[model samples]
Target: MTENTQHDVIRRNPLLEAAQEEMRKFERRENEFRRKDREERAAELQLPLAEIKVH
Candidate 1:
């Protein structure tokens, strides 16, 4: 077998495939959550509150 074929076999391992898929899912969720939090913080900061009126 050639060197390229050997490398392809290793890349096709089931355990490696599962681990890579899990990492992809985790990264996607992390990015989504971070983006949402950033948007919320930006919105909060943009709000204008002139004075605090206590009753």
Candidate 2:
């Protein structure tokens, strides 16, 4: 048997997985809010809304 570094192997980490899930949820909600805000602004000015650029 041989020893390997952490980054050299794939493993399941519950804590990291949970944190990633939370970030995904946050991003989805933020995108939704940005979409609505853009739409409302466009409506106020009588213009088409532009596409949102997600980072």
Give the winner by TM-score.
Answer: 2
Cα lDDT tens digits, model 2, 13-41, are 66678889999999999999998887788
TM-score of each: 0.61, 0.65
Q: Give the range of the ten consecutive residues with the poorest summed lDDT in model 1.
A: 46-55
| Candidate 1 per-residue lDDT over residues 1-55, each given as its tens digit | 6999988888789778899999999999999998677667757887433352312
lDDT leader: 1
Which 10-residue window of candidate 2 scores lowest in summed lDDT?
A: 1-10
* Runs of candidate 1 exceeding 4 Å displacement: 1-12, 47-55
lDDT of 1 at 4: 92
Question: How many pairs collide in each candidate, listed in order?
Answer: 0, 0
